[model samples]
Structure formats: C-alpha cells, structure tokens
Target chain A: MTHFEPISPLSVLDPRDRGGPVQPLLTIQGLKKYFHSAGNSWFGAQSVVRAVDDISFVIHKGETLGVVGESGCGKSTTARLLMHLIKPDQGEIIFDGEKVGIDIPLTEFRRQVQMVFQDSYASLNPRLTIEDTISFGPRIHGMYESKARLISHDLLARVGLDPSRFAGRYPHELSGGQRQRINIARALAFNPRLLILDEAVSALDKSVEAQVLNLLQDLKEDFGLTYLFISHDLNVVRYMVDRVMVMYLGSIAEIGDGETVFSTPVHPYTKALLASMPSMDPDQPTREAPLSGDPPNPINPPSGCRFHPRCIMAEAACSQKRPALETTRHKKSMAACLLQNRDTPIPFPPIKVSGQ
Target chain B: MTPNQALETQPVIARSPGYWHGVIKRFSRNHVAMGALIVILGLILMAVFAAYIAPADPIKGSMLRRLKPIGTPGFPLGADELGRDMLSRLIYGARLSLLMGLSPVPIAFVIGSLLGITAGYVGGLTNSLIMRTIDVFYAFPSVLLAVALSGALGAGLTNALISITLVFIPPITRVAESVTTQVRGLDYIDAARASGASSYTIIRVHILGNVLGPIFVYATGLVSVSMILASGLSFLGLGVRPPDPEWGLMLNTLRTAIYTQPLVAALPGAMIFLTSIAFNIVADGLRGAMDVKS
Candidate 1:
C-alpha cells in the first residue's frame, strides 16, 4: 500500500496571525449569491434570485454562531456559501489565516470543514451500509489506513450506536435519529475544524431533536469545534448558539450575543420573530401585534430596506436608502435599522422580555 | 432457535440489507419480468454453447434430407431449402442472432452515456452542441438510418452491427443524459463538491453511481430491439451472408419452401420470436428491479 505524506501548507500556520485577539476562526465578508433563471416566454423577464445578498458574519473559535430566519431568507444559502458548496458571486472566506475561496481543493477543504445536511433520511446514501456511509469521508481523505472496520466501529461508538449491531445495517433500516447520528459521525470522522449543521435536527421528532442537540453540544466541547448552525427554530438556536444573527430577505437584520438579542432585540424584524414564539409560562402576557405579509419575492426585492414593507417602524429614510448594519448602544452588537441611528430619535417598540 | 422463533425474527434480521437487496426483492415479485429474465438467460446460454448443441454442420446439406417435414424421426425439426438440419441450424443461428443483438447495446450505451452525461451535467454551449447533434441523428427513423448506414458501410455482419449501434445511440444518449442531469442536481453531489472532491471524482463517485442503474436497465431493454434489427438486416442480405446459420437469413432461404413445408418455414420465425420475447421479458424484469420508487 502506497502512503503519501500529509502535505497541507495551511495546517502549519498559526491561526492567531489572521485576526486580532478575540479574532474569529472563520470570517465571511460580503458573501453574495445570485441565481439567474433561464429566460423563457412564459416568464417575460429574466431575473436573478438574490439568494444570499451581501451577508457577512464572523464565527469565533469554539463557539456556535446561529443564523436564524424564515424560509427564503438565505440562511441555508449563507451556509452553502460559507462551505463553498456553491460559489459566491462575490465574497472572501478566511479560515484560520488561509484565504479560502471557490478554487480550494475539496479534499483539503473537507479535512477542515464538513456539513451535516437537513434531511437525515435523504442525506445518507441509501445504497451504502451504515458503516460505509460513516467511513466514506475518512476513506476518501485517506485519514484511516487499512483498518477501516476498526475506525468505523470507533466512529459508530462515538455517535452512541453499537457498531457490532448497526454497522452492517442500511439507512432505511435505521430510525430518523439514528440516521442523523450516523451523518454527524461521518462529518466528525475527518476531525474537521468547522462543522456546518444545516438544520441538522429539523426533521427529527421533538424528543429526538433535543437528544441530538445535546449530543452536538457534547461533541463540540469534546472536540473544541467551531460551528455555523443554521436553523429556523429559535428555541433550538437559543439552546445551542453563543451568538445569533437574524436574516431577512437575504441580508442580516441583527446580530448580537444570544441572551442580549433574545432579551432586547433592536430590529423590528428580530423583535417580531421573538414575539411570534409561543411562550411556556401561562402567566406571561403575549405581544398582540402580528407581522403582516409574507417575505418579498427574492427575484425583485423591495427598494431601499428589504424589510420596510414588513417592518412596523419604517421611516422616510428607510424607503429611500438601505440601512447598513452599524453598532448600537449595546457593545459589540449591531442592527441594520435607521431606528438604531443616533440622529434618529425614532420611538421604539416597548421592550418585551416574556420568558426571561 | 426453534423454527417458529426463527421465522418470527426473520423480518427483523432482514431489516434493510441495502438499496440493491431491496431492488432485487422488488424485481423477484414481478412474475412477467422473471419469466423474461429466464428466457433471456436461456437464449444467452444457447448462444454460448451453440457449437456443442447444434446436431449437424449448419451449411452442409444432402439431397436425400431436402424438404423433410418437422418432427420426422431422423431430422426432428426437418431440413431447410438446402437440406441443412433445421434443428441444428436453428441452434447454431442463436450464436449470430444473440451476438448481433447484444454486442451493439454496450457500444451504444458507452457512447451515449458519455455524451448524455456531459450535456446534462455541463449546461450551455457544450450541452447545446451535443444535444443538437443527437437531434440530427434522431430526426431520421431508426430503421431507415440503419439501412442507409449499412448500405454506405457496404454489406457485412460487422458493418450491419456498426450501423444498428449508430441507430440506437441517440435514444440511449437521451435517456443517459436525462438521468445524469437529475442525479447531478442531488444534494449529495453538492455535498461531494463541498468536501473538495474534484469534478472527476464528483462525476465518477456521486453522479455515475446514482445514474448507472437506470441507464443499465434501459440498455438491457434495447438489446431485444437490436437483435430484431440485426435479423432484419440479415434477411435483406445486408448482414450475415449465406451458409452462415443466422435466423433472419434462414427465413430468407426457407421462404421458397413455404408451399412444400409451411411448418419448417415457421421454425426459424419461431426461434426469432422466442429469443426476442425472452430478451424483452428480462429487460422488463430489470426495469422493475432497479426502479427505486417501486
């Protein structure tokens, strides 16, 4: 058997050199994705679907950065862009001093980054055995030698499955939770620096989702891993992430520490998202105001602020110019709303901290 | 374990063996498909052992045996126009007919799959060029195209095979292209790309693995059509020449003996029908077996 020396130049560089103290492990600057639909007679005009429009975020080492939004807000597209699953039309992805881009080799990129997909049932190859699916990454990257069975068993055990019993089984034979665990195990087998969980537990039942979330927390602690967790479920994001970024219509509306954002959301859209969640305490009063209208068509988003049509606190400036994400009164927190501006003494919505 | 206990646990033990096992089990339940598979396999075996199975030399003839009726004591299926033993010649004819039928399918499949996969996966100019080329060939009817190609290539078994293979390439390419296109859109292929798998690796590992099963089943179905076409070419004297015991050529030679022994003339036609039917059955079975949705 021929063995090649591990020849990755990026691995030898010190991660701290890329950013200052408290610098992010992964920094995505100005990420954008525009999907052009083929022009046809039925649809008179050809348009670009601005899926992930100039979104930016930083993922600190050993912390989970949760990206939350309703569907079509480009949360999934952001994850894909960061992972380089599809090339971003314009952006720079810097991972640990290495300038990561579309041209980076997948085998080397796979060693540092991995993704756990949304649908556990479809994520795994139905044709492969459970062991084979789990071992695919390690085998492909040449991480394990000839003792594939032993490595597969170790991975299966790490994911809390009995390798002796379940290793030979196929994906359809396993339950949804089990398949998801196998998927996670497959990603972890490569010892990746960053793991992107793209609604990893969304498809599982409530109890199974909790279990998987717990498992994820444990795995992160054990491996000292960074995560880009994309989810629509606010409850799960609160439990799993250190910081939360709210996306609306392919742009970040607000970003801050999880507790700060949950307790006192600055953006109207963020507040609306939190307010919509069903409260557990019967004694607690609910916000009566409901967010009106569906998300704007991504093909032709509203002019100026994309959320102005849906936002309750829209002003004259909101309709004319886009609100850039600027820092507010809270240190290290930002909101993309004219209301957050010092010059604008705009009356804000009453701060409602229901469950806290 | 007791027999009852063992029986009870069988379903649990079986679980899901894998995707391929599921496909096989689904295929087995289709009776019409299974019968076709058996017939195809039987024809293949007959073709492979044609030399040992044939009772006499296919080309040799004697005046005494000429015009002998089928089911006669000495010559069970009687003799052809030249007095060649009908049973011996029919058995020998299996070799040429099956070869002519089966050989062109793989050639067409390889050419078509490459073209189709490229066109479907890589959109824009490359796709447009390959698809338009395929359309040009598809514009002509398959039989007419094959006949023209054979005439251009000049008459021979190999030339006829080449012509028929060309005739089938467009349809096979279309099937392969569509399947590959669908497979390319799957999430796993994107996952593979994210993992830093090269374009070649993505195509070979992720795309081809998913698409091949459907393409293979389609190719198997085309085998029967290729065989019949090959036989037709032979009957027209553009394929296997005289003295070579081919089913189509046998029909042509025995056409004159129809008045004297109608049953003997029917023998070659019966062989062609049985062989073609067997192939079609097997192809149907494979289609049922490989269908993931079923």
Candidate 2:
C-alpha cells in the first residue's frame, strides 16, 4: 500500500479556549421531516414523503462533522433543517445548551449559525457591490464601529481581498473561486459560532477547491469554530473533517471518527461509497462495482432497511425488520445492519487504506 | 506583515474601482441605448423649457392663420384648428405630455414594487392574496382599464393620470413580485437570513437590490404606454381639456383640418410617435444593459 502522509490538524488557540473542557456546540435529537405528496387521483389515497426521517448527530466546539451521502439522500435537507431555513415537521435542535423550540427568535440563532451554499455562481446578488455584500451582515447585526470603512477594510483583508481593490465590484466581475471566498467572507463577517457548509466548494475546480479547503481549515483554527460539513465527495470530507456521518435514504447508516470510518467502514453503504471513489491510480486493478441501483423514492420508501434492496450482504432478516443504529463490537463505531448481529462473523475482504 | 506587503500579496486585478469601471464601460458601449438616452434627455430638457421655446402664445389663436401649412415663413409646423402656432403648441404640449408620461410611472413603480416585494418574499397566504388581486386587474386590458378608471373618476387631467397610474400598477407589481420571488430564492438571501438579518433587512438589502433594477427597466418601458393613454384620454376630452395645449388635445383640435393641410394635423401625432418610441428604445437598451445573462 502507498504510504500517504497524514496531514496535521491546524490549531490556533483563542483566549476563550479553556484547554480543559468544552461543550458540544450543536445537538440534534430525533430530527424527522416528512413531506406530504399528493398521490394520483386514480389511486386510493395520498402518500407521504419522508425527506429526512429520524436523523440525529452532535457537532462539538472547534470540530467539523462531515456528512457524506449521494444525491437525494437528504443531506442537503438535513443541513437546511439545521439552519432552520425550512421548518422540520419534528426535531429538537439544541444550540449552546438551549433547546431551540419553534419560533425561537431566529435572529440570534442566525448570528450563531450560518450556512454556505453549494452553487457559488448563483449564490450572490449580481447587482450589489462586493463591499456592500460583505458589509451587509455587519451593518444588519450592528457589529460595525463608528468607522465602518475601517472595519469593512479589515474584514476584506482578513478574507484575502483588498477593500480598496475589490469592494466596489459586483458578483459578475469575480471568478468562481473568488466569488466563493467573498461568500465565506460574508459568512464570517458576523462571527458565527457554527458554520454549515452545504457543498460550499463543490462548484470550484480541483486547484481552487484545495485552496478554499486550506483557507477553511485555517479559518476554523483561527476562530475556534464548529462546522457541519456536507458533501458527496468522501475524500474531501476525509481530508477536512475530524469525524464522519454516513447518511443513506434520510437516515444515518454509520457514524465514527474520520480515520476509523475511512479505514474500516462498518456499514455496507459506507463501504460501497468508499469503493466508488475514483482511484488516483488508473493502472491499479478495478475495485468493487459501484452501487447497483438508484436510491428508493422518498415518497414511499422500502420497508425494513432502506438499503437492504441494494445491499450485497443483505439477509432474510434485513428485508423483514428495520435495523436500528447501534454500537458494533467496537463500541466507538455505530452501524444500522442485521449482519452485525450474526454469529457467523462473515469473512469480509480487508479494505486497503491508501496511507497505511 | 506590513499593510503594503499584505496588499502586494493580494490578487492584482481585485481592485473594486477598476472592476466597477469595467462594468460601466461595458454598459456604455450599447449604442441604441445611448441614442435613446440622448433622446429622452433632450425631451426632458425641452419639456422643462417649454415656455421659452414656443414662438407664439399657445392658447391665444389667430383665426386668419388657421390651417396654415408648416414651414410657411414665420410659423413652423403651421397653426391648429384654433389657429395657434402648431410649433408653440407642440413645444408647450411636451410639458404636459412628459409630465403625464413620467409622473404616473414612478407612482405605479413605488406602489407596485412594495406590493410585489411583500408578495414575493412573504410567500404562502400573503403571496396568494396579493397575486390574486393583481390578477383581477391583469384580466382587464390596460387601455380599457385606464379608460374605465378615467370614466369612473370623471374627465379631468388629474383623474385621467390617476386612472392611468392605477392601470399601470398591476403589471409593475406583477413584474416586481416575480423578480423578488426569484431573488428571494437565491443563496445570498438565505445567507443574509442565516446571518440574523431581519425579514425587512433581507428583503430590502438582498431582495430589493436585485429585483428593483429589472422592475425599473420595465417601468421605464411603461412610460410610453402612459403617454399614449394620457393622449387618448385627452383626445376624447376626458383628460386635459381643450386650450390646454396638451399633445392629445392638440391632435383632437387639429382633426378637422386633415383634408386641407394633412401635414400640419399629423405633426402632433408624429411627435407622440417619436417620443413614445424614444422611451421604448431607452427602456429596451436599459433592459439589455442591466441583464446579467446578456
């Protein structure tokens, strides 16, 4: 196996850092959102769409929790739910030890929690000057000093853009990467405690993505911020996040430390996702085949386990009973699969870690 | 690091002033729009200085000089049925016509934009109610609605202008609502909301900034419609009454002299066409210049 060098996590100690203890920044419990979709008139009754059915996770202070899944797996929806952009039918979102109930004055919540969207190109207002765009939040939140110009300039410099040079420009003037940096600058202007990056760097090219990822890592350290990083690319997630949560069909299939989850995936879905990553070496022998079929429709999901129909190691019990996410023999990891209960200990082939 | 060193490390082309200048330069290159802008400016100047430009008294007439052909010595564009200098009347007519055209547009724009922004950004029940009300007005043809409103309000210049302005509000509101709704869905708006921006702040800063440009462009296009409607109302004696020197009223006064000097009677009609087309061209140019897709 190729010895991939492990990158050290960036650390910048803030005055507030106690070094002894820290609390979880955000905790979501039993979050569920079912979208009601009208059925065909010819059919008997209307059906319900379980967009984000029973998903839960906790993001600690100064850490990034990466959620990885394919499209329509409710990853984006979950992020939106956390941001409270869309109201969830059922869920408990606790922030800084306070349970966020319905109508819980979003202004304060918004200041604490900010989200960076996927499409950087369409994310900005075309008509607004770059300075106005960045200063917008500060002005709205009343964060500016008497000299707003000086403060705005400082913020622009912090984001690696000169206020004098770039402030007056509009969105159309900047490139994809530059626009994304501006987006980040805008989010950070308010000094948010938690940043929800919803595929933030997905639109950029590889080189730009790498630069942005580095900037994010630096920002995280500098601010001591917690992040809920959402993405479909497992490698990028592995590189950026401290822990990983694998979601499949609106539910978490697995959750563990990033290193452990990548090195030894407990869930079959997570294993398949890892296998599907295009290998860096083209000449290497082909790995396992990509996922067989499309995800089951959210309007009417399959019974028992949602992934059972497509899972390779599925058994009779997997098709009959819904598996709950529980700790495996290694208590540090969690997986929702009946196979973990089997006494046979199915002899699965060993996964080759790239940086062994 | 020193401030200069930090500046040196920054991207070379990231200067804000230079970038904005580039956008402005690109917008300026549109020739048809520039020409239209010049025409509108000239009309505005002419309207503002209408009294000084007219050669003879607009309301005072010469029965002997009635129906005189244009370019006949002292009188240019000849005289109307009342024998008032057509040139003088045309110049003075610009004041009322431009006022009637431009004034109602902004009124409609302000009312429409507020309703539209609220409807679009709020969504749900509010959106439905406002949109349905706008839909009711939209069902009527604009000219018919103006005529109906004028008829209801009874035939005065102010009443006609009011009716025309009301007639214009539905479309402007519809445009504003649609544009705002689209803008509200953008990630920046969501980002603004996520940054603890109040609903008002998000709508004003993010949504309004994006939506207003297109709405203003559309409203500018409506100025011509307003001019025509104003003229039509005046022609029917339901707008500015006779002897007011309004363009539409002038056209109506000159109608009887069609057989004798067709050119003289057609002068006011030609002016209306030119001014309306000028406003339309300017609107079109602005739409093209402001459109990001273009």
Candidate 3:
C-alpha cells in the first residue's frame, strides 16, 4: 500500500535495464503443469488442475527474486518445476543461455541448482544423522567420503550449527528452527550457483525467521549465489529480495522491483495481499478485504482473466478478454489489468495504517 | 575465525544410543514380550544343542519299554508310543520346528520387499503390472494356498518350505508397497531426487531406511504364522519324514496311544502351543517397540 511503510519513498533497488546490457542466467519460457483429477463417478469426466499455466520469467546471477501468492496459486509448484521434481507438461527452461532438457542432461542443471523446501522436518530424512543428511548430496555427486565429511562439518558450522554438537543428531532430535538451518546447510552443501527456497522461512518463529534471513543474506554475499525466494510474507519478501513476482491462480499478475511492487502495487490482487498482512500499529484502522470469497477452483477456473470473479473493477470485457502484463512509466513497475485508465492512472489507494 | 563464529562453535557431544536400542528398551519393559523372548531364546538354544542336551537317543525305539509312564527309570519324561525317549525326541524336534518356522521368512522378506519397494516407488503401469500379478496369489486364504501348492508339488520339508514362502510373499509385498507409497511422498524424497540421486539410490539409501523398519516388524509377525503353517504341513505327514522327531510328526504318531498314555501324548501338543504363542507375543512386543509413530 502507498502509505503501508516508511520505506515506500525509497527508489527501486533492482538492477535496471539502464545498467549496460546484462544477460539473465536462467530463462523460462511457457511453463505449464496440469494434474488430472480422478473420475468423479464411474463415468464422470476427469478434470484437470492447472497448477502452473503459461508462465515465463528470468533470473540473473546474484539476484534474489521473491515469488508471493496465496495458497493454490501454484507458488510451491513453480519451485518444484525449477528443481525438475515434477515435470512440466509444456515448457522450455533455458539455463546459462543453453536449452536445458533431455539433451543437455538434467544432472548437470541439478548440480548448479538446489531447492530448500518449506516443511523442514519433511525435507530431511528422519533416519539420517545431521552429518549424513548434509553429506548425501556431495557424496553422491562424486566427492570422496573424507572430503565430503569435512565439507559437511564445515557447512554445519557455517549455518551456525555446532558441528560436534549437532552433526550426529537425527532430525527428530532437533527443533523446527534447527532443522530448517540444516535444510539450508544441505542446499549449500552441493556448491550450487542458484538456490530456490520455497517458503523456507515461513515456518520459523519471528526471531528465528530474522536470524535465518540474515544468514541467507550473508550466505548470498559470501557464496556469490542467486536465489529464487518464495514466501507468503510480503514484509519479509520486501526486506530480502531485489525483484518480486506476484502470482494469481498460477499466472504472473505483477513483476517488478521489490520496492515498487510492495510500495505502489498496481494489480488488484497484489493490493488485496498487502491488505491481508497484519499491521503492528494498533491505532491504524483495519481495511476490509478488497475482494472476498475463496479463489475460484483451479480445476475449472473462470474464463478470460483468472482474477475476474473477485475483481471489484471487473467489467463485462473482463470476462471475455485477458489483459497482458505491460510496463508503466516507472520503467520497472509492471502489472496486468484492463483498468489502466492512463489519464488519471487509477489513483494508488492509501493503506489504512498508523505511520501515515 | 571471527569472535561471533567462535562463540557459536559447538563442542563435541556424545552420540546418543540409536533406534534399535530404544526398541530393545521398550520391548524389555513389556513383560509379556520379555517372557516370550526368553522362551524363544530357550527354544533356539535347545534347537542348537539338541544332540548334546537330549537325555537319550531320540530315534531308537524300545519294544519292552513301549508306552512307559512319566517319571519312569531311564525315561525322564517317560517313553512315547514307540517307547522312544520323549524328552530327547521333543528337544531334538526343536531344531526341525524352528527350522521349518524361520527358514522361509528371510527368503520371503528379501524377495517380497524388493518387489514391493520397486512397484510402489515406480508407481502407475509398472506398479499395476507387478501388484496385479502378485494379487493372483492373494485370491485364496494363505493356509489353503500353502496346502494346495505343497500338495501339488508333492510332500517333503523342502516343498512345504517353498509353498509357505510363496504364501507369505504377496502379503509382505502389499505391506511394503503401501508403506513405501506413503514414504515416497515425503519432502526428503523429492529433496533427494533434486540432489541428482538416481531412482535406484533413492530406494536403497533414502526409502529403505524409513520403510524397512515397519516392513520388518510386519515380517516378524509373519514368522509366527509361518511356524504354525510349517507345523501343520508336518502334522499331515507332508513334511519332516517319519521318526525324525518333528513335533508335528510326533503328534501324528502319538494319536493312537492318546487313550493309554494321555499325558505323554499331550507333551508335543503343549510344546507346539507354547512355542507358537511365544513367537506371537514376541512379534507383538517387537511391533509395539519398533513402531515409528510412537
């Protein structure tokens, strides 16, 4: 929201187009994953859930790109697709300017990219000791046992875990936050260039979340790594990422500099998400949800614009014609909406918060 | 190193005891299971040392001492219908009984688990193909299937063991496949896959540790079932040939003398019941202790 925070007045931190033609490290084109539902009855039609449908984006080296959306928006699915955990029905993922697929070999792409899952306990094998869990990636990728063991202990120490105290402990013996740290350490064990964290910090306590976020920033700087950070918390995303991508029912609704998107959000769905975040200011008045009712079922999504059913600005044309993502005058902020109305440019709404 | 880094440095901590230790500790607490385990251990020791521990030669039958009562001189538990030393024969029978019960289990566990883990992890067409084929064996009651197969294969200890092993396989596979299916969806599996681990590696290293415990516990339960079936095979004279001191065969041999020497005749039956029940209680204890959910 325009008046949501004191940081809104600050300019964008994203590396812009004016910064001398830099090529993106990874480029995704037309990705889609549709899950076929079981038959309703003996003869009922099998519906399909469009988990990720027709999305494209690029990530540059050493950049932290945050993906935010409500549940069922396919935020986690996108991460799995990048990791190649689940095959996309249709898409081409171009990494380092080369087409990455059957020919280039997935193991080569996987060696460079690693993902940290949201549920920490579920992400670590319950049977493995902390040392084995961390070393599993390296040992399988051809590192010798002794060298891998040394690397695992080094990673444990780097992630703030005392190697001697924590190395032999299993996942069940550790707390939620400690396990999350181990998850991060395991991702870094492979010496990956790109780390995709799918809601990695969303499960931690407030204080632990801050510590983890700080650890991530330090790791990114030290390792010179790029991150595709996914989270539901806009506040944390605002503090951590360079650019942000807002998804709605598996399609990108807004993409731009993190500051611009969070401070002056143009898409209707993005505005609603910001409003949903609990404000610390007791004096600030609560704003009613801009759009109500659960998101349309993904199995049979609404026609045209996926957000049309809940859109307050929906028009007759909204139901029949989709709006393409277009850039604004800021050169960084972009949104997909039929209500651009350039002359007045749909006045940016003031968020009801105390600091304003 | 920096000060903060040094401050967070962990000291060497003693490694705690592992999962099996906890299972043993828990099992020790269950009195029924402990008693059963003790009995089972005794039975195993008897089976191992039967040649030395037995009071007299088990095979030689004496016509003058035929049907000797309990506490008779030269016969500790008295003589059997053929005037054979009952104590010696029962002790010697321990080896064959345990052999019949346990021999089929490990073979079935290894083969069934392989089929199941593979089918479950590889899901869809391969899963259907393997599982459906295994299901054909599942169509009949396990005992009936064992009996029919062994009957068709002809009577003998080897044929009985083979048929019983076949009978246990489908159920073990079903359990392994279901448990594997459940473990297959956990986040660590996807994490392992993303780490560039091959499917084979996933099953052996990652999935095996988690699913094997529950499957093994389930197989322990099958051990008792296998023991009973093996005894049944010998009772019908399809296993452990005559005068070999097999408990089941002894039961068959002593049936005619049941009226005249009732107490002596009941000894073999009592041994069969106690051993099977001991195995069953032990299986129950192992299940409770090995339960990962708890």
Which candidate has the top score in DockQ?
A: 3
lDDT of 2 by residue, A1-356 (tens): 21111122225433333322365678898999987664463577778788899987788877899999989999999999998888898889987667775434567778667888998867787767777777777677675533444455566666677666777677888889888988887777666778899999998999999999999988876666788999988889999989899999999999978888898877878887887787789896457555755788888788888888777677788888988888877776788887876776533332332210
State the DockQ, from 0 to 1, for candidate 3: 0.57
**CA displacement after TM-score superposition, residue B145 of candidate 3 (Å):** 0.4
- Candidate 1 CA-lDDT value: 0.81
Candidate 2 chain B lDDT trough over 10 residues, lowest sum: B13-22
TM-score of chain B of each: 0.89, 0.92, 0.91
- TM-scores across all candidates? 0.86, 0.88, 0.89
lDDT of 1 by residue, B55-140 (tens): 88878999877989988887989988878899989888989998899899999999998999989888678887999999999889
Per-residue lDDT of candidate 3, residues B1-294 (tens digit): 997565456455436567788788889999999999899999999999998899889999889899988899889788998889999999999999889888898899999999999999999888989999999998899988989999999999999999999998999999999999999999999999999999989988899988988888788878778878887888887888888988878888888989999999988888888888888788788889876456
Error of 2 at B194 (Å): 1.1
- After superposition, the stretches of candidate 3 with alpha carbons farther than 4 Å from their true spots are A1-21, A38-43, A102-104, A342-356, B1-34, B62-78, B253-263, B288-294
Ranking by DockQ: 3, 2, 1
Lowest summed lDDT over 10 consecutive residues: which window, candidate 3 chain A?
Answer: A1-10
DockQ of 1: 0.25
Better of 1 and 2 by TM-score: 2
Q: How high is the lDDT of residue B125 in model 1? A: 84
Model 3: per-residue Cα lDDT over A257-281, one tens digit each: 9999888788877887777777778
Model 1 off-target regions past 4 Å?
Answer: A1-21, A39-45, A101-107, A147-149, A279-289, A341-356, B1-35, B55-57, B60-69, B72-75, B78-84, B120-124, B253-263, B291-294
Better of 2 and 3 by lDDT: 3
